[model samples]
Target: MRVTITLLAAIFFTAVSYAQVAHNNLFTVGIGAGLIGGLYDGNYPYSSLKQHGNFGLGAPDKLDGELVVFQGRIYQTQHSGKTFPVDDRQLTPFAMVNFFKADKKIAINSALNKEGLLHLLDSVLTNVNGMYAIHISGKFNYIKTRAFPPVKAHDHTPLAAMLPLQHFFEFNNVQGDLIGYRLPSFMDNTNISGYHFHFLAAQKDAGGHIIDVKAENITIEIDVLDSYTVHVPPSRDFEQFDFKKNRAEDIKSVERGDKKQ
Candidate 1:
């Protein structure tokens, strides 16, 4: 009877240990997915309207802005502010961005398949827009608008070095024409209408040396003026949506083997 009881206890403990390992693995995978999707959603930039040259007609400086452009399409125009407005006339952009050495392991040993992972990413992307206001908080300064530091081959090891402050633009499920849309105009005009996203990477090398800690923030405000005429509309406020307490915490509880209350 004593031996039988010991064997049963051992089985129970083994099962618990296995469960804990699985939980940790799932947590890691979820965190990775969150980071990737968040970064991807944050990088889009707004095109600034610029006066290339005066049209033959006595029109003021010909102000023009481009809509979404692909990865390498450059929009180099002189603008006063860090944020620019994207014209609705421009085409919706599509591009795939890859972060080097973000993931330490190549093979993801999680239950999430490619389709499942993409779905999870879509959910994350959907929640990000217009949901939270971004405030710059970190070491890197965007005041200078400095270019990203170059990457070296030696910086390939796990956490060898974090990528330099980086930013990119990504647009998904974009709708509406680029030219017909109009933006809000204000008398004071302090508050900018658009989305600005930021990301900071923290990495630790194999030697436990902290390297390549950086932050990248991009602001892409959609320009309403280039697209449509203004019509004064009644004010309607937004409802507060909380995903952290609802979705993130629920996933955490499941991984921790705690029953949902």
Candidate 2:
């Protein structure tokens, strides 16, 4: 009958729509700009994140600390530079994840500082506008990292206000992993552009958001993720937060880690 044919057509179209949406390589809960505005209240649990990807990074709810996912385990590096295993019940306000499938792997033994390393990796990417996940493992000549203390988000405390409270740590001749992503320029508001990484020492004792680094004799893995899928947080704070203001400079300043180290 005509009605049966119409129902079948509807189902077919719905299936196609889901297929198109699920194709994006990157899956993120909330946007990066929310952090700039202090929207740090979310209920997205680490268990849910584990289901999405094993290699990614983000922050825990209430700006508790730096959240890093390496290999298949999730670790929370606190402000004191101590790492702890994150429970499945623990939640994150913002995070980026992907089912990583490496497109290429490169070996570099030449001495390179953070800037140099970033430049070298940048040169490897032929498409400047493309998004890619980068994994660097091996010895680090020197590395500096920092983590934010747990700041109450319900009170509307801006991230800038919590800047002075961040704790920094430095290590030399250490073994660790740097997990992160390099996104396109157009995703400024949607997410952070350029390279962003979080460090976790091999001992699983110390790590945080990477501020600077110097490395040699390391294997760098690159996974190209061309598209992204964002899941908006359903929290009341997220729904009410004002996102109209431009926070590009704020984001850049924070990312640059310009403070005396």
Candidate 3:
């Protein structure tokens, strides 16, 4: 009886371990470097991207506007701070997505800025080397965001050159949700190393890339990813493009809207 019980226990433990490892996965199309280097052509359509995951962020074809996938519905936030539903036929040049299932929840009782918020998350982070999907929703005392305007289709101009033309906005006491990821440093070329968040304002009508924020009395949901896969486009342009150049500074400027150093 003791031997039989031991065998059954081993089987149960093995099953649980396998399930935990396969529970979370991250799917991404195109690399962050491609977005900054002007490989802005559409690689995947919204219809196909939906199959990978339901919650994430990216840019529409031609880098027209900021793309946010929330609750299985896709939205585009234009320079006007107005959000609109995206067509299934619309394509994306760069996107990161995952079927989000919260692994834990943390509630805050004090106001915190972007840096402070990171510190709070880091304090309880399960693994600093693992990727985490974060969802923070509620009223924000203050938040600032930015969005890029549409450019000509297949325009070869690097995204950095357009930062001066990007529009910025600030909101006070805004009700919204922030969808983003906290990636490990090893993922530098594949995605933003730290945090890359997009905001959805109250009623889901306004949003863009979150530049800054202050929050209090809100819940933060975190999902630790177990695996991540990158799908590099199979295009002649991508084939000949150089991925070796250290464009880290340029990429940061594109993401933060900072002037090129």
> Best-fitting candidate, measured by lDDT?
3
RMSD (Å) of each candidate, 1 decimal: 25.0, 4.0, 4.4
lDDT of 3 by residue, 1-261 (tens): 999999999999999886565447788899888788888888799998888888999988887669998898889998877789898997898899888889899788789887898788888775879899998988799988899888886676878888888889898998889999999989997787888899998688888998888987778999889798888887777887788988788877876778847
Error of 1 at 209 (Å): 26
Give me the overall lDDT of model 2: 0.84
Model 3, position 11, has a per-residue lDDT of 99
What is the C-alpha local distance difference test score of each model? 0.21, 0.84, 0.85
Q: After superposition, how far is residue 116 of candidate 3 from its true place, in Å?
A: 1.1
Which stretches of model 3 miss by more than 4 angstroms? Answer: 1-23
Task: Please give each candidate's TM-score.
Answer: 0.16, 0.89, 0.89
Predicted candidate 2 versus true structure: per-residue lDDT over 1-261, tens digit per residue: 999999999999999876544433788888788876788876798998887788889988887679888777889988777798888897888888876667799988789998899888889987989988899999999999988888765756767666778888999999989999999889886889989999999998988888889997899989887678788988788888888888777677667654333
Model 2 / residue 116 / CA error / Å: 0.7
> Can you rank all candidates by TM-score, best first?
3, 2, 1
lDDT of 1 by residue, 16-64 (tens): 9864433222010012112211211111122211111100000001111
Candidate 2 — which residues are off by over 4 angstroms? 1-24, 259-261
C-alpha displacement of 199 in model 3, angstroms?
A: 0.2
